[model samples]
Target: MANVAILELSRNCAKTVEEIVKLERKIFPKHESLASFFHDELKKKNSGLLYLHVDGELAGYVMYSWPSSLYASITKLAVKEQYRGQGHGETLLKAAVEKCRTRKVSRIMLHVDPLRTPAVNLYKKYGFLVDTLIQGYYSSDRDAYRMYRDFDSS
Candidate 1:
């Protein structure tokens, strides 16, 4: 059986941040990746990261920020290719949302590539609804869907 764990990352965690950055580069396009700014992001008071390990191996992670008490945003969520379809993404997402809930945020939002059906489905399953379509949100050739989940409604 696999041992699963979710850990909240702190800014001082240099070694773990490095590992996450490596995984970030592998999962996202260069321009869209947070690798270059991850540490800086963690330095913000309202932002944080949660990473999951399966049997002591990095499986996935989610980065989130609540700039105000009313709203929170999921900045990134990624799972290693080998770990896809194993529910790690959902697990990370649930953690992120719960973190926001603890902050008493009224809503949580995220932007995802519309082309990624599995990701879209996962968010929908978690009660996130499409709020808008942002043209070229990822790149000139790509677009994204801005999705949100309202805590009050659920």
Candidate 2:
């Protein structure tokens, strides 16, 4: 998998709102509208993501939002369910961090469902701090933990 290809997607991929919304639904079953995806919710966030492919097939993806400030945020990170535990998620995350570092981003933050132990553990391994958790952070259906990491400025 050392030769796996990773591509940074352009803003426009011609994907239908329905298909994109379907993917979001997998993560947030109470899924919001696609309108919010490009507007109000992550408006200030300029997405910098990489699609991970192994053996020419989609393995995983990491989507992070670069704000061009001292901090950045990861909007989403997921590996196809069948592909979990193979380190693809970690690889995707490292790619995101590398991209942020290259762009001079010093801090990165992300929200994950508190009950998602595997994800929480993976993030902890990557040095993210448990920043804060709002009781109803995710939605009425789930609670989320906000994790953060700030890198050395030098």
Candidate 3:
């Protein structure tokens, strides 16, 4: 989308889930989409926020939550196929970092699919260091690497 706006997703998040499912399905043939996880997280009323955008006809979405928790989690970050290379991902990440800083979180955490080299590189570029590796993490025959960015709240 030419105009990028960040909205706190409550209802529009349903659409976001759909997009995520579609993307995830491309990689996982039999895996279900994570739309429910997004909905449930919001329903839990925890400290999570999703930033979404309208790109003419497509949707660009990034979700982040738990900024105030001991280990705030970055649940998901996705941009539509046509929206990639548009800097949307970086902008979303910057916003997520700022949100974490505002919450005074000690650390930010996210799990990356080991096979996804691009994602791994992106996290590294963003200064997220590997915390550990979780074997057999994804049911889709994928391993997960846990990464974290330590932000001093002091």
The TM-scores of all predictions, comma-separated, are: 0.97, 0.80, 0.79
Instruction: Compute the lDDT for candidate 3.
Output: 0.69
Candidate 2 per-residue lDDT, tens place, 5-124, comes to: 777765565452233345555655555323346434333446665777677666667778777677788877877776789888888888888887777878999988889898999899
Give the total clashing residue pairs for model 2.
0
Candidate 1 per-residue lDDT, tens place, 54-84, comes to 9999888999999898899999999999999
Stretch of 10 with least lDDT, candidate 2: 33-42
Better of 1 and 3 by TM-score: 1
Residue 110 miss distance in model 3 (angstroms): 0.3
Q: In candidate 3, residue 148 scores what lDDT? A: 94
Can you rank all candidates by lDDT, best first? 1, 2, 3
Error of 2 at 153 (Å): 1.5
C-alpha RMSD in Å of predicted model 3 compared with the true structure:
3.0
Per-residue lDDT of 6 in model 2: 76
Identify the candidate with maximal lDDT: 1
Q: What's the TM for model 2?
A: 0.80
Candidate with the greatest TM-score versus the true structure? 1
Candidate 2 ranges with C-alpha deviation above 4 Å: 1-3, 15-22, 32-45
